[model samples]
Target: MGAEGGLRERKKLQTRAALADAALRLALEKGPDNVTVEEIAEAADVSVRTFFNYFPHKEHAILGRNPEHLERALDRMRTAPAEESPLTTMWFVVQDVLRDLESDGQLSRRGELIMSSPTLLYQLMMSSFDDERQLTAALAIRMGEPAGSVRTALIVSAAGAACRVAMDLHKNAPDRPVVELVREGFQLLAHGIDPAFDQRGIS
Candidate 1:
């Protein structure tokens, strides 16, 4: 909380970001499974031991962006209007922030690679709970409720479901824009998913 603590956290964050960026580049240059921890550490300008200090394993380095992005979303959510519902603000802010990431066609290509690869897909989905925990805490404070309250639970559940739905839709229609998938996912969450399906079938 103090300046010293803040400095330490920021420095750690920088190291983590660097490590993930290096890993991503390596994965694209070669392949995710082909890239080694030492390679990523060297690319990050750190020793392999120091890499372990930031991430437990090579896969952790590959998946580290999820937590980093969630942290950014929390910072943005903290600035939401006080009068607005926390669930709504958090949802919109997260989507908006991720939309920026999705807009980068290159990064989305990385995402597509990760999603298509059977090994990374399972790990990414499994590790996503870490992000959900941070989101639940942020929403709880904003909603003036306990972290595990029904509202918080519902919001987290719905938001997570929407994200998965969007990803699945994106996988099916790789040519479609990510924003369109996200928009359609949110619409299904707002109304009934059945209606979206029915309309799509009619189209």
Candidate 2:
């Protein structure tokens, strides 16, 4: 039963990813306002009912990050070494997330789609805020600080900036290694963005 359940869950994830990929590609190809849930379902070779099963609406599918990926990131953040600083932990998390997204080869396309639509961009930002809140709470527990503390927000903001820069760099230079760019961004953040600092590596 457990094995069967695991298989079922994997199938659900695959279907959700297919719907999202279809919605994103269609949105980019034919503007977000031009896309329809029926068309998205057809593109994914699923019924409109199946599309609704995974996403509440067309916009959600276009702007959605995979739930499996988000859960994996949160789990990694929670299980990261206690001795590591929050920034260091987040650096590793960002690297892992980027690597996983790269394996599927959709991160750049998703970014482009989001940027092209104001509504989608707003939805994505709202989703990100929820994620940030959860991440901040997790880190605050580790540091024995309030989740609302300025120090906690600052750390999260720095890590988030590095992530955004890494993603933007990847979108511009698809051939370059994202992990390397991420390392450089984080190293700069860790060292107060000193242009003169040795950035041979991040430690």
Candidate 3:
């Protein structure tokens, strides 16, 4: 019975992802303004009602507003070794999340769409603020700090900023692996900004 329940949940998630992917693909080919919910449903081979069940509207579908991924990241954080530093655990969680996203191939397409559409990019940035809040809360819980503590907030904010910078670098250098860029971004955080500055003139 438990296995059956889990399988059913997985099917639901797959269906939701399919719908979102279809919407994104269509939006990429034809502008978001021209893509309708019905067309998205048709592309995904699901009924319009099913599409609505997964997303409130076309915009949400295009943005892929699923919180399950974030929840899974939090679960990874919770399971990380107690002795690991919060930054280390959080970075590991980010890598896991990005690896899964990169494997899906949808992330690169979404980045392209976001870059091409000013409105979509603005909406994505707004949605990221919500993601940051959720991540900050999860990190605080893992560190045993109060949900809204300053330390957690600052750490999460810094991490978020680092990721944004890494993503921008990835956008510019699509040939390079995003995870590698992300690691470099974190190294900047760990080693201090402009690590080469002191030796620049001497060499």
Candidate 4:
């Protein structure tokens, strides 16, 4: 892209991020239901019309439309070695994503804000469901199986569960490295989630 085009793209990304940050902050301070798109746009120093150019609605702004981690995970799935299982590939991908989230403190704050509001929480859940569906389809294509097949669905959902469990555990134990917790979760899945599975022996 040309210099002028690149500058415009950067400006757009900056504005979008500013809007999302404002939405999360305001929601945290005044409850999600109480927050309005006009308030959010004002917080970000943008007009209401400009906000619509970036996001369809307030919920979308709060969630943020970009799913960088999902995109990266899909790319890893595509390039993973032929012998690697889908679960194994996702184990690393989840940890990598979690580490990134941890580095960006704002993400933890976003999670807190989302959890505080039922509306935001439900929207986030639906968004995650859609992400899982996309990943399931990608895995199916890679394995030459039907996207809706039970086997593919189980694999994707199980992996997603492990990641969620790890995040929950980390939330309860703030002193622990989330990536380490994520590995333990994946280790359980690797061993059939067996009661007798030795998690420490996996790595």
> Which regions in candidate 1 have their CA more than 4 angstroms from the true location?
1-18, 64-68, 75-79, 96-105, 194-203
Candidate 4 residue lDDT tens string, 13-61: 7898789888878877888888899999999999999999988789878
* Cα RMSD (angstroms) for every candidate in the order listed: 5.6, 5.1, 4.5, 5.0
For residue 33, what is the lDDT in candidate 2?
A: 92
TM-score of 4: 0.79
Clash tally for model 4: 0
On a 0 to 1 TM-score scale, where does candidate 1 land against the true structure?
0.70
TM-score-better candidate, 2 vs 4:
2
Off by over 4 Å in 4: 65-69, 96-100, 166-172, 176-180, 195-203
Residue 147, candidate 3: alpha-carbon lDDT = 70
Q: Between prediction 1 and prediction 2, which has the larger TM-score?
A: 2
Q: In candidate 4, which residue pairs clash?
A: none
- Could you tell me every candidate's TM-score relative to the true structure? 0.70, 0.82, 0.82, 0.79
Error of 4 at 105 (Å): 0.9
Please write out the lDDT profile of model 3 over residues 1-203, one tens digit for every residue.
99999999999989987888888889988998899999999999999999888887888889777767678767877787889877787687677767666766877667666666777767767777787788788878888899779988877677767766666666788886767777887887777787667785688
- Please, what is the whole-model Cα lDDT of each candidate in the order they appear? 0.72, 0.78, 0.79, 0.77
